[model samples]
Target: MIKKLLLTFSFLAVSMLLAQKNNDQQTVDEASEKLRLAMISGDKTVLESLILPELTYGHSGGHIDDAKEFVEKLVSKKSNFLTIENTNQSIQIVDKTAIVRNHLFAQTHDFGKEQGEVSLDILYVWQKTKNGWKLLARQAVKAEKKK
Candidate 1:
C-alpha cells in the first residue's frame, strides 16, 4: 500500500511538472505572436512592451540595432513594415528562456527610401521575466533570392 502511494505521488509530481512546462511554452508562444502582430502594425509601444529593456538586434547585413535605436526609428516614423506574414515558426524552451525561429515575409519601406518585399529568417530570444516573458535578442537574416 505504501509503495503504491509513493508511486502515485511520484506520477502526480511528474505530471505537474510537465503541465507547468507546457504552460510556460504557451505563454512564450502567445508573447511571440503578440510581438509579430506589433511589428506588422508598426505599434512601437507594443513592441517595446514585448522586448527586454536592453535588447540586441542583429541584421543580416551585419548591422546591429540596439533598443534605443530601434525604438527611436519607430517613433520617428523612419521605418514602416506592412503586409507582414510569418511562417515555419518553432519554439524551444530551456529553463527560464525560450528561442523562437521563424520565416518572415513583409513589404517594408524603411526610411521612406528602401521599399521591397523582404524575406527574413528571424531568431528571437525570450527570457522569463517577473512581469512575463520579454524578448532579449532578435536576429534577422535576409533570405537570398533563388535564381
Candidate 2:
C-alpha cells in the first residue's frame, strides 16, 4: 500500500511539472505573437510594454539598437514594417529565460524609402519578469537563399 502511494505521488509530481512547462510555452508563444503585431502596428504603448528597458536589438544589416532607439525608430516610421510574417518558430524556456527562433519575412519601407522585402532568421531572448515576459535581446541574420 505504501509503495503504491509513493509511486502515485511521484507520477503526479512529474505530470505537474510537465503541465507547468507546457503552460509556460504557451504563454511565451502568445507574447511572441503580440510582439510581431506590435512591430507591424508601431503602437508605442504595446512596444514599450513588450520590451525591456535594456534591450539589445540587432538587425541583419549588422546595425544594433537599444530599447529607446528601437522604439523611436518604429514610432517615427523610420523603420516602418508594412507586414511581418514569422514561420518555423521554436521556443525553449530555461528557468526565467526563453529563447525563440523564427524565420521572418517582411515588407518594409524605412525612412520613407521605397518598399522592400526582407528574409531573415531571427533570434529573440525573452525574460519572465514581474510583468510577464518582456523582450530582452534580439539578433537577426539574412536567410540563405534556396537553390
lDDT of each candidate versus the true structure: 0.84, 0.93
Give me the runs in candidate 1 sitting further than 4 Å from their true place. 144-147
| Residue range 40-142, candidate 2, lDDT tens digits | 9889999999999999999999999999999999989899999998999999999999999999999999986999888999999999999999999999999
Residue-level lDDT of model 1, residues 1-147, one tens digit each, is: 999999999999999989988999899989988877776676878888888878998878888889877777766657677667778888888999999999888787777586877788999999999989999999999885322
Query: Which run of 10 residues does model 1 get worst, by summed lDDT?
Result: 74-83
Per-residue lDDT value at 62 in model 2: 93
Give the range of the ten consecutive residues with the poorest summed lDDT in model 2. 138-147
